[model samples]
Target: MAAFRDPLAGFVPDALVLVALDNALSRGWPDAAVSDLTRDILHASGIADGTVPAPAFAALLGDGRADLVARVRFLRMALGDLALGFDALTGDLPTFMDRAQTFGLFRYDKAMSDTAAARAEVRPWVDYVSALTRLEAAHLVPRLPGNAGPDWLEIGGNSGAFAAAICAARADVRITVSDLPAVCGLGQEMQKGQDRIRFQPRDARKSGWAAELGARDLLLFKSVLHDWPDHHARAFLTEAVACLEPGGRIVICERGPFAAGLADASFLSRLANAVFAPFYRDPSVYEGWLRAAGFAPTRQTVQLDMPFHVIEAVRA
Candidate 1:
């Protein structure tokens, strides 16, 4: 089996989570499936708002792009982690009996979301960026011409996984990866040998990155933009237009379309922290954003047996 981000060591043990399982499996389910069931349980337990009492397990298995034990680990972790509120012994339900809401649950919500405050607080369990290693990272980047020497900028590219992938695939490109300071620190280690790939500290939420970072031949945002509201996303794209030279290219890849949530991003971000991860918007949304930021683009879906959408725009 492929490895995921590693170190789910979030104050809980993998075995301890599995022991709580009380059901049979049918087929591999997506993260959306688990999110819905958990939502139902949360509501049935008397909470109408979509919220989990504690951190949900395997909530991010989908983020890794492959099935980890056919969602068994995710389900079992749910049964184990959030088993305090609901009454586990009643009705058609096989396990949960009460609210099943437990305190002291493993929580990565704070560090993983767009609302994260500082890089210092990020823990091992929140290192979702390395999850890219489990995937063929090369497929995530655009296929540039063999002789094209591109200066690439990867925003929020934690650990420079994508940069390393593309650099291995090409010879003439120099890539700079930017993320939170601490994440950049981690990337510096993961990106030791490749002189072509370097680490630069950047926060996507901040402005003026384009002015400070200078121009690049290509800019890539993989699994990054959807974490923000449309406005911030728009601003980032707008900034990208300035960051790239007049004829540069911008590429954005996300799992699926972002279902634009509540208008208030701060509130939505806070809600997201306590909610069951995220979803997506259509590729057109990104196309529109790209157009608004000044680019004529082409879109393609990654044929990697996963729901990855790639949008590329060249500033003219």
Candidate 2:
């Protein structure tokens, strides 16, 4: 027999967590005494089983994670203060969505859907891709092992910025970023000054894609797999297995699966994420893919404002 719990009772601690988060914000994240207060918010126990994920919040203390924290801080400001305002709870969402749609969010996606002529100016994915290069890249490079060697390959790398960041960090490492022809052209122009980083036009969707890739010390799939269905992701990993040296590594950097559970005390943030938290995956799911692809995988979740899983698989 189990004791019955109050159905609406969970909101109590949720409310307290909200209070603490609000107080923390007033002092601000970069201000003195914030870290201690943050620790309290993270460790504070509550009745609700679904509190914010602790790892993402705890990650602010780690090295090189500041860039992501800054990005999160800016986003918090961009969303504006929720005080004395109508959240979706008060019927703002219906009207807000209607207005945001008018700004061409759907139109932008529609433009990109055209295979023969995807508009570059609209760049529906610019914010996401920019976060990769500007915010997450610095944090990503440090986690990759030194065995990444001189020859590194990034499959489906857009704009080649991740590879550029790696090359900038490691003078000895040369990298090649492979993507569609259109993206390659843009990447070539954007990455022009970087001597060690180059772009190659390759449609990863085509069969026998890796036959000409040559041997490489490391192959990376940075935030690329989640958009793919499981079968495609598994098939791509199988194809990638043959492209690496015996001791070479395959590093997959992806966002952890999104849960409706609030990661912050803010309901507004959760509401925004409900729109779509692009990185949808479980590290275990990738483990199965790695096993079938002929490598032993090890997983890590690093806090880059939001939690990101770095799965490393070493070739057998």
Candidate 3:
């Protein structure tokens, strides 16, 4: 029964063996210490992997009288502390997400039905396009308050996924996805059949956008601000707020802080500098800019796996 519950004991035992090997290699411990820690990590890994039978572990390690127990204890303590200390060195998840958003690693366009061949032609990178689709469907759109039509505008919409999700779910709502010409072109292709969705080539911070995009019930700045500095983010927000109708709302979706997990820090930070260094502002700094632009945040939500944050504000 115990074996059935944790069938992967063999695999886990192997992993613990590897960790022990790596630790031994790094620490240069004496032969005995190396052997002991190796055995413990292998045992623990096996347990975690669900391959090690708990009863077997008890039979082996249960005898507190053995030196093996002491060795296992030392190995666990050393490895756990090492993991925490390394984590500290890597920086936190929020910072990493901010960087990811900036760097375009979160490019979120992995496989557009319209461009699957093109995307597939290139091998996988750490793009976040698929994740974005999920977030738009699950978290970002549902939180939106309006049940109205043709009343939304998306700033920094790269491929119209957000607008597409909105139009797909709520047929009445029309959104103009505004971005630079190249990006708008891609989005235009993506939104081809949907008359309710249109692509406009425009910059968010510029004045002409107001007249071009016109008033909207909701202005969406999805994952754009972190690519900018504070002043620019403020300027963009000011423009967006101006183009909103009275009692209208502006929704900003971004990568939530410290949420991406450990392996992503370097990838995320590098990505941020690439795509968002021009406009990326820290979340706190961006919050201040939003207030300065005369918008008060009414709601903020965090979503997992996709590294997303949705902030809804009303024009004040």
lDDT of each: 0.55, 0.61, 0.54
lDDT tens readout by residue for model 1, 79-105: 443444234323323233223221122
> Cα lDDT of model 1 overall?
0.55
- The order of the candidates by lDDT, greatest first, is 2, 1, 3
**In terms of TM-score, how similar is model 1 to the real structure?**
0.59
Estimate TM-scores for all models. Answer: 0.59, 0.62, 0.54
Candidate 3: segments with Cα more than 4 A from true spot = 1-131, 147-149, 259-284
Which pairs of residues collide in candidate 2? none
Best by lDDT: 2
> Comparing candidate 1 with candidate 3, which one achieves the higher TM-score?
1
Please provide the root mean square deviation of candidate 2 (C-alpha atoms, Å): 11.8
Error of 1 at 196 (Å): 1.1
lDDT of 1 at 238: 82
Total clashing pairs in model 2: 0
Q: Which stretches of model 1 miss by more than 4 angstroms?
A: 1-126, 142-149, 258-278, 303-305
Rank by TM-score (best first)? 2, 1, 3
Per-residue lDDT over 1-316 for candidate 3, one digit per residue giving the tens place of the 0 to 100 score: 0111111223333324535534543443322344544556645654322323246444543432233322333334334433444343255544444433122223434322334454432112212332234334556677666643358888877667777787777867888887655556566665689888887867566676667778888888877777665677777887887787888887777765543422443332232222322333335555666677777775565433334566777656
Which candidate number maximizes TM-score? 2
